[model samples]
Target: MSTTTYAVLVLIGILFFVAMDLGKRDKGNDVITLISDDDDQEEHS
Candidate 1:
């Protein structure tokens, strides 16, 4: 009903989403990963 209430609801929603995401990651259901290799990406002239 108020700004503070809305903010708290949003925070709770975000925390729940993050908790689910972490659970999925632990189960290896996520496919995204970071494999950056700057040296291998150098310009080949």
Candidate 2:
């Protein structure tokens, strides 16, 4: 009935859907990697 009540309800709804989406996501395949030979050269130098 109040503005605070409406805001709380909307926040709850958004968080519930976000939790569901995070649960369904992949565990490892989404990883990104950078192959930099710079690190190896730095060690030698």
Candidate 3:
């Protein structure tokens, strides 16, 4: 209806697509794998 409305709609659409993509990628693997690396103190020491 208005330029501002169209702009807001487009911004929302882009955010939705980005969230979907992140969720899809997260489903395939163990998200906690990064935590294992955090336990390795030898590397930091």
Top candidate when judged by TM-score against the true structure: 3
* RMSD after CA superposition, every candidate: 5.7, 6.3, 4.8
lDDT of 2 by residue, 1-45 (tens): 699999999999999988867865743223322224556667889
Better of 2 and 3 by lDDT: 3
- The residue ranges of model 1 lying beyond 4 angstroms of the native Cα positions read 28-45
TM-score between model 2 and native: 0.51
Better of 1 and 2 by TM-score: 1
Worst 10 residues of 2 by lDDT: 27-36
> What would the per-residue lDDT of candidate 3 be over residues 1-45, giving only the tens digit for each residue?
699999999999999999988986986355455555666765787
lDDT for 42 (candidate 3): 54
lDDT of 1 by residue, 1-45 (tens): 699999999999999999988887795433333222443465442
Candidate 1, after superposition: displacement of residue 22 in Å? 0.1
In model 2, the runs with Cα more than 4 Å from the true position are: 26-45
Q: Could you tell me the C-alpha RMSD of candidate 2 in Å?
A: 6.3
Candidates' TM-scores? 0.56, 0.51, 0.57
True-structure RMSD for candidate 3: 4.8
Q: In candidate 3, what residue range of length 10 has the lowest lDDT sum?
A: 27-36
The candidate maximizing lDDT is 3
